[model samples]
Target: MTRAGTAPAVLLVVVGLACQEIGASFAVLLFPQVGPLGMVMLRLVFSAVILLAIARPSVRGRSRSDWTGVLLFGLVLVVMNGLFYLALERLPLGVTVTIEVLGPLTLSIIASRRASAWLWAGLALGGVAALGGGGWERLDPLGVLFALGAAASWAGYILASARVGRAFAKLDGLALAMAAGALLSLPFGIADAGSALLRLDLIAIGAAVAVLSSTIPYAFELIALRRLPAAAFAILMSLAPATAAIAGFVLLGQHLSWLEVVGIALVIAASIGAVRSSSRAARETAEPLA
Candidate 1:
């Protein structure tokens, strides 16, 4: 895309990332009342409601593969969101996002099939190691595991979402998959939240979380992805850790040390390098033999 086109897309992505972090901060506030699983259920359920209302996806005459793809996509959503929230409950938001991003970073490197991609991988390892600069024991082991699981699930979500997008038009696939995920989480949500879910105020806040974290971001990203190169989009997404940190500090009073900030910066740098390398490799492969 040209510079003019890239500017708007980059703006959209930044807005989406900011909204996402703000939503996550709100979720942390509700963790005391609803627990992380409850927050996940509320977020997914409300997001599904909004998406279904907007998309009104057709249900008739869909193929079996289409249904299967949506189902798997829904499963990925549940795992990704659930693990992410669980990690957030134990770790700071910025750290959680930084670790979770490794899924996409690894995916980009492997897809690039370039030897130089390993250099970025090494940088990312250094970043992760630096995150525990205070001490490895300072970071919760279980939280790190949950973050890792979220990372894997996020990678699955990207692949599954792409397959579902191909199978359905507009936001139809997303709406259907979100509905499936909501239903799948219903029982667990009810169990975890109990009567706390009955509060009208909490319900209202949950709607806001849905809009900020899922609905608006999805819409913005969908539009931006249409105009932006995948590499450029990935580069923009690498800013999530910084956004999360800002949100955490401003909204949740969670502060990070200088070492942790440096760690986040390193991860962001590695992500950008990996994406640029991948894009360059792709372009070289597409060029005509000279």
Candidate 2:
């Protein structure tokens, strides 16, 4: 695609990511009333409802493997969102996202055949170290752990989502998986939210969060992906930390140190490098022999 053609898709990606961070900010606000797990339940349940209504996926005649893929994807969604919200409770939004992104970065590194992958890995390590700013105690250890768990779950999510995508048509797989995730989260959401879940206002905000965080982004990305290359999309996704930091500052009054800023920049840079390397390798492998 020409540079001009790619511009709109790039903007869409940025807009979607910005919406995601904004939704995260809202989720953080709701945490006081619903708690983290409760917030997860609200987001997933609402997202599932919206998706299922749109897709209305048929349950009949699915292979065992299809069901298995959907189930595993659903479980990954629960773990990824649950851990992410839990980390948000303890850490600043920017910090949590920066840490959580390491999962995909690690996956990219592992998949890359180039020696440059190690250089990118080293850069990422440095960035992580910089996040501590000579004192790891400044960051909440438990929150960091939660973010790491979220990170791991994110990697699993990528794999599981791909599997489901191949096994089912269009949005059918995603809708079903999201419904399954909502069902699995019901116990914890109910336990944590209690009577607060009964409030109409809170339910409305939860629905908004689901739309901003999941629905809008998914729609935008689906459109953007048709125009943008996968590598370009991955590169654009790396900007999430910066957007998260901005949302944190504007919405939550969360501030970061200079070191942390540098750390986020480093991670973003490394992520882009890794993605480029991987894309190049894939292209080379796909080239026809002369």
Top lDDT hit: 2
Instruction: Determine which window of 10 residues in candidate 1 has minimal summed lDDT.
Output: 1-10
Error of 2 at 91 (Å): 0.5
For residue 43, what is the lDDT in candidate 1?
A: 98
lDDT of each: 0.92, 0.95
Tell me model 1's lDDT, rounded to 2 decimals. Answer: 0.92
- The C-alpha stretches of model 2 lying farther than 4 A from their native spots are 1-4, 288-290
Model 1: CA > 4 A from native: none
RMSD of 2: 1.1
Per-residue lDDT of model 1, residues 1-290, tens digit only: 37778888889999999999999999989988888989999999999999999999999999999999999999899899999999999999999999999998888888788999989999999999999856878899999999999999989998999899899999999999999999998887888888999999998998899999999898999889988887888889999999998999999898898889999999999999999999998889889764
C-alpha positional error of residue 174 in candidate 1 after TM-score superposition, expressed in Å = 0.7
Which pairs clash in the backbone of model 1? none
